[model samples]
Target: MPAPPRNILASTDLHDVRWLRSSYSTGANNCVETARPRSGPETGLLAVRDSKNPAGPALLFSAGSWAGFLTAL
Candidate 1:
């Protein structure tokens, strides 16, 4: 089996990543934004951070895990 994805201590650690918000989000800053690291150790993981706090910690998820999570929602 593959290893599980890990969480990043800070979203700022991911330099040069473009975080995107959901189209369903209002401009209220109450939602989360997601980004994919194109290179480095974070590559292949989905990075998620709170829109309310851009420099805060980000949670990382494997692509398959993220897909499963969305499917269950």
Candidate 2:
């Protein structure tokens, strides 16, 4: 068996992250996805999870923080 993915949040209330599909996803193979809250003033707190793991869990990051992460990649 493979190793489990590392949990990103130890005590985050994931109820607030609103998931959204990438308009560019092909929906046939592995594709990248993203999500954010529907309404909020929270800073640097965007939620992200794997598309294949809807029932699993998610990682939380600030909007700016997440942006910086992506930028680094």
Candidate 3:
């Protein structure tokens, strides 16, 4: 009923997530990483973070928004 959680102050806060990289990405790690939190406040939402900074803040998006973003791309 309430809005989903927003930016995570530190990626480390998501202890249960498994960040995934795109297969199309190069080994340089320049792409953004995405994860779906299986537990905690972020569960069922998408978590995105820059590969260049693993410990940096992560932004969260709802499933509908994520799908729309991919469709828009």
| Tens digit of per-residue lDDT, candidate 2, span 1-73 | 4432333442234456566777777777365445655443332356676777666566666667777998999
* Candidate 1 runs further than 4 Å off: 1-5
lDDT of each: 0.90, 0.57, 0.93
By lDDT, the better pick of 2 and 3 is 3
RMSD (Cα, Å) for all candidates, in order, is 2.1, 8.3, 1.0
Candidate 1 per-residue lDDT, tens place, 1-73, comes to 5564588878999987999999999989999999998877788899999999999999999889899999999
> Best candidate per TM-score, number?
3
The total number of steric clashes, by the backbone 3 Å criterion, in model 1 comes to 0
Error of 2 at 73 (Å): 2.7
Candidate 3 lDDT tens digits, 1-73: 7777988989889987899999999999899999999998799899999999999999999999999999999
Q: Return the candidate ranking by lDDT, descending.
A: 3, 1, 2
lDDT of candidate 1 at residue 43, scale 0 to 100? 86
- On lDDT, the stronger of 1 and 2 is 1
Model 1 TM-score relative to the real fold = 0.90
Clashes of 3: 0
Clashes in each model (backbone N, CA, C under 3 Å)? 0, 3, 0
